[model samples]
Target: MSGSGSQGNGQRLRADCERCAGLCCVALPFTASADFAADKPAGQRCTHLTAENRCSIHAGLRASGFTGCAVFDCYGAGQRVTARPELTPGPEMFAVFRVTRPLHELLWLLTEAEATGHGGAARPLIAEIEALVDGDAAELRGVDVTAWRARVGPVLEEVSERVRRGLGGRDLRHADLVGARLRDGQLRGTTLRGALLIAADLRGADLHRADLLGADLRDADLRGADLADALFLTQPQLNAAHGDGTTTVPGALTRPVHWPSGSSPARHEAPHRARGMPPGKAAPVGGGSGLGGRSGNGRRTGRGGRGRRNDRAGGADGTEGPGRRPG
Candidate 1:
C-alpha cells in the first residue's frame, strides 16, 4: 500500500547521522542502563563522536553500552540545525538542537498527515512550522513551544479525525490496545496515533496507511502484519517493537536489524494455531552506537532511543531500555 510518494516523505523523518554534526552524540546524554553504558551530562561531547561528527563506535553501540543512542530519530532536524552557516562543533549546539528537534518532529507528524490525504487540514500548521524551521537562529532560539503546540495540536486532531474516517468508521486514536488480540484484522487508514500498542498481537493484520504517529509500539508483535504505507511509522518505532522477517513493512522502512533470526511456524503452515508465534522477534533489547541493533554483528545499526530528556532544566538526554519511557 505504500506508494512511491509516501516513502519519500517517510525518509525525510528519519535521522541521517552522516548529515548531522553529531548533535545527538554530544548534545544529549544518558545514564548507565540496559541501554546506556554510563551517565552523561547535557552539552558534553559523547566519547564516541569523532572530529568529523561520525560516531566512532556506531557499529558497536550495543556492545559498547549505548543502545539508547541507536534508536533515537531526530526526524531530520539534526541535519537541518547543523547546517547553520556559522555552526561550530561545541556545546552551544545543544541549545539549538533542543529548540529545533521537536519542531522537526512536528514535521514528521505533519508529513504523515499530508500523506494520508489530510494535507489540506494540516497545511496551515505545516506552513507555520516550515517558517519556523527556516527562520534565523535567533528567532528559532527564542521560540515558544507552548504556543506552537496550542496552535498546531488542533490541526493534528483534525488530521487524526480524517484518518480515522478512512478506517471503516473506527476511531482507535489513543486507544489502549496493549496485549489485545487483533490478528488478521482489517485496519486500513486507521488513526492509531498516540495509542499504546505494547505487546499487542497484530500478526497477519492489514494496517495499510494507518497513522502510527506517536503510537508506543514497544514490544508489539507484527510477525506477518501488513503495515504497507503506515503513516509516520518511524525506524524508532520499528526498533522498539518485535517483528519477524515475514512482517510486511512499508517499502520505505527497513526491518530492525536486532530482530531474532529465528523462524517459527508460518500462518499457512499452521492455520489452526492461534498465538503460534516466535516468543520474541528480536534479540535482547539494548542500545547500540545509537538507539539499538545487533551489536558487533556487522548488520547495519538500527534507529535508536527515547532518552531521559533534558529540554527545560537541561539536565541530560538520551537512551533508555524497555519498561519506562526515557528518563
Candidate 2:
C-alpha cells in the first residue's frame, strides 16, 4: 500500500493533478518528438491543456504526441505551489518546483530508509532536510544544491552500503550497461545513476538502496527484484521496467499503475507479447501502468529505448529525468 504521508509534517511525493493548476504543463518546456508532440516554452501552457487547468488529452496523450506527459510525475510539487497562490508565476514559481523536487525526492528516500529499518544517517538527514524544505522559498533558493547533495548523498550511500553489502561502494554512475546480461545480480548500494540499462536482464536482482536516479529501465526485467529503499526512483521508472507483484519496491512507491496484478505475467494475458522483440518487452509507448515491453517478441521493429519517455532520464549522462511539476 502507498503511504498516506500523514505523519506530523511528512510530504506526499506523488503528483495530485486534481488539486493542481496545470503548473507542470506550463512551468516546464518540452520539444516535439516521439515523446512529445510539440515544443512548449517555460511558463506556457501545453496546447492540450484545458481552461480549468486540466489536461485535455490526458487519456490519449501518446496518440496526441504528448507521450512525455504520461510519464511525468510532479511528486506533489504542483499542489504545494498552487496552494500558495501568493507566489507569483515565472522564474520564482518555477524555482519553487525545481528546488523542492530534489528535496521531496530526498524525503521519499528517507521515508524508504526508515521503512527498511535504517536508523542511521537517514533520520538525521530527514530532520535537517525537512526543516530546510519547510522554510521560505527564497531561503530554499539560497541553499547550495550541490553542497546539500554532498551531505545527504554520501550519507544515504553509506547507509545503503552497510545495510545491503551487495556490490557495496561501487561507483557505477553513467555506466553504459545497456542490454547487459546481469539477471539476479547483487547491485545493492551501487550507484546506477545515469546508467543505460535498456533491455538489460535484471530479473531477481538485489537492488536494495541502489541509486537509480535518472536510470533508464525500459524493458529491463525486474520480476522479483528487491528495489527496497532505492534512491530517486520514480513511478515512471517502475512503469517502464518489467516487474511482477513479487518485485519489492520502496515504501513510498506503489506498483506501476499498468502492471499485471500477479507475481508474474503470462504470455496469454499479456497484450504486448510480440515476436522478435528482446527477452523483456515494453508496454505501449505512453502506457505506464503496465510493465514496459522493450524488445519483447514482435515489438522490436527497430532500435528504440525500453520506454520512449525513459530516454529523457538516460539522456546526456542521465540527468534529464521528468520535467518539473504536473498538470
Worst 10 residues of 1 by lDDT: 289-298
Give residue 186's lDDT in candidate 1 (0 to 100): 82
**Per-residue CA lDDT of candidate 1, range 215-319, in tens?**
656557778888767765666677766787778776656677766555535332121221232221111122111111111111121122322111121111122
Q: How does residue 269 of candidate 1 score in lDDT? A: 18
Give per-residue lDDT, candidate 1, residue 37.
Answer: 65
Q: Count the backbone clashes (under 3 Å) in each candidate.
A: 24, 22
lDDT for each residue of candidate 2 in 1-327, tens digit (9 for 90 to 100) = 112222412446667777776777766655444455555666676676778877766656646654445655555667777676557667777767656655655565555555544535678778887688677879876766445555655555555455546545477765766677777898877777656575677878887667675566756778788876565566667755677788888655667654566777522212132112223222222212111111111121111223233332112110112332223
Off by over 4 Å in 2: 1-11, 88-91, 166-173, 184-193, 204-214, 224-232, 244-248, 262-327
Instruction: Determine the C-alpha RMSD for candidate 1 after optimal superposition of all C-alphas.
Output: 8.9
User: What are the runs in model 1 whose C-alpha is more than 4 Å off?
Assistant: 1-13, 186-190, 260-327
Distance from true location, Cα of 248 in model 1, Å: 2.0
RMSD to the hidden true structure, all candidates: 8.9, 7.9
Best by TM-score: 1
